[model samples]
Target: MNESNRKRGVLSPCAACKLLRRRCAQDCVFAPYFPAEEPHKFANIHRVFGASNVSKMLQELPEHQREDAVSSMVYEANARVRDPVYGCVGAISSLQQQIDLLQTQLALAQAEVVHLRVRQNASYSSSNSHGGFYAASPSNSGSPPTTLPASSRGKAIYNMDMVFDQANMGYPIW
Candidate 1:
């Protein structure tokens, strides 16, 4: 008896064949993508999509496109195992939600930075016109005296409390 023929049946089967408990032929379509080392991968796929269906899918596709088709099927099958109800759609929806949340946070942070820069510029301008900027609070004593240096006499004097009105701000960041 030839040694090749004797040992051929004992050759280590591909992951797909092992999980399906079937003979793995020399030209098995799943040999490349579904190596025997990682049985769990094919097991997960088989659990979701039966071995017969996978074989039919592989047989239907052209030889050149079989590898990509198997990869996509495995990925989708794994995802389906993780999320039974929505499968890959659930993962896609989750990722999209996270992206939207991150974008909103980024927008709010940018708005805050712009607001701070404007406030800083205003304070710097106020100080440059006079020796320093003074803050006034509306107290029971009386309305604070509205006086300005000769250089800023015609310029409008801004009140911090009034300037921080929520409606005046471009976006409601909070």
Candidate 2:
């Protein structure tokens, strides 16, 4: 009768009625309909040629193809799962600070080594001039060296006979 009613075919509804401003009738799920709509060009083409179609084709394939498809999916998932997880910015920055601290310590150690080397060279230069820094080698000089045997349990041997020499030093008239 009217332009809107004439467009209403045997219970097919418009996109607007089906989706929004919900109202329904017995014949159509959503009323106030339109009919003989042309299919969306891109959506139809995608349905025929896209990944969904490819997946369907794979599903209908032989056993080896199906296994290959599943394995590829699993491999992709594993790669995503096993990827090295990066820490947050703060953690990474803290690690960098630790590295910087270690580098500074290394530099300090290197400087100390250089200082020690310089001191060693200075001592070597002064060794003959000043009789510097006694090294306890039996071949060179000095008093008898003390050595500990395995049986000596951290005790030093003192010569008590020298301490008692005063007693024997008294008058010897005989």
Candidate 3:
């Protein structure tokens, strides 16, 4: 027993040793990573990877790397338990899809803002040219304008309402 174990009176076996129904030696490989207080941590790992495999893996690794390896094993084991077939990969894929959807929505909103700005500029220019009063152009008599001027079109402005309608149709343009 080490100083800490000896000071605590009767030595408490580590989780791995307790689960395996064996004594925990002073130099137990699992003692540092799987303390007695956190039995579930080791339980999940043990359920996924057998006790012998964990011990052999820990023994093969350097002391500094053992802790990280144990942590990774515990995470993978828990993920495996939660999702038997796809595990962590499924969680990662779901998050990536959400990110892609959010990005598309953001791009669509940005395009809409640019389109509105172009329409506002066109409206202002027409009003200025016609004695500071709004005048309905002959191309859009008694109806709202649907297209920007040729100069504004060169600035990459498009019909935002049409773009949004297309997005609702299940096909999103890049």
- lDDT for 5 in candidate 2 is 62
Tens-digit lDDT string for candidate 2 (124-156): 444534465545443323433233345743333
Clashing pairs in 1: none
Query: Which of the predicted structures, 1 or 2, would earn the higher lDDT when compared with the native?
Result: 1
In candidate 2, the residue pairs with backbone N, CA or C atoms under 3 Å apart (3 or more residues apart, or in different chains) clash, namely: none
lDDT of 2: 0.41
How does model 1 fare in lDDT? 0.69
Ranking by TM-score: 3, 1, 2
Rate residue 157 of model 2 by lDDT.
Answer: 35
For 1-174, candidate 1 gives per-residue lDDT tens digits of 222532475557888888778888877877767878788878877888888888889989998898888888888998998899999999999999999879766655665775555454455555455565444333212323343457954454443343333444357643
lDDT of 3 by residue, 1-174 (tens): 444863464668888999999988877889889888889999989988899999999999999999999999998899889998887898888999999899788766776676556666666667667777667875324344343457754464554465354466364443
Q: Residue 141 in candidate 3 has what lDDT?
A: 44
Please give the ranking of all candidate structures by lDDT, highest first, separated by commas. 3, 1, 2
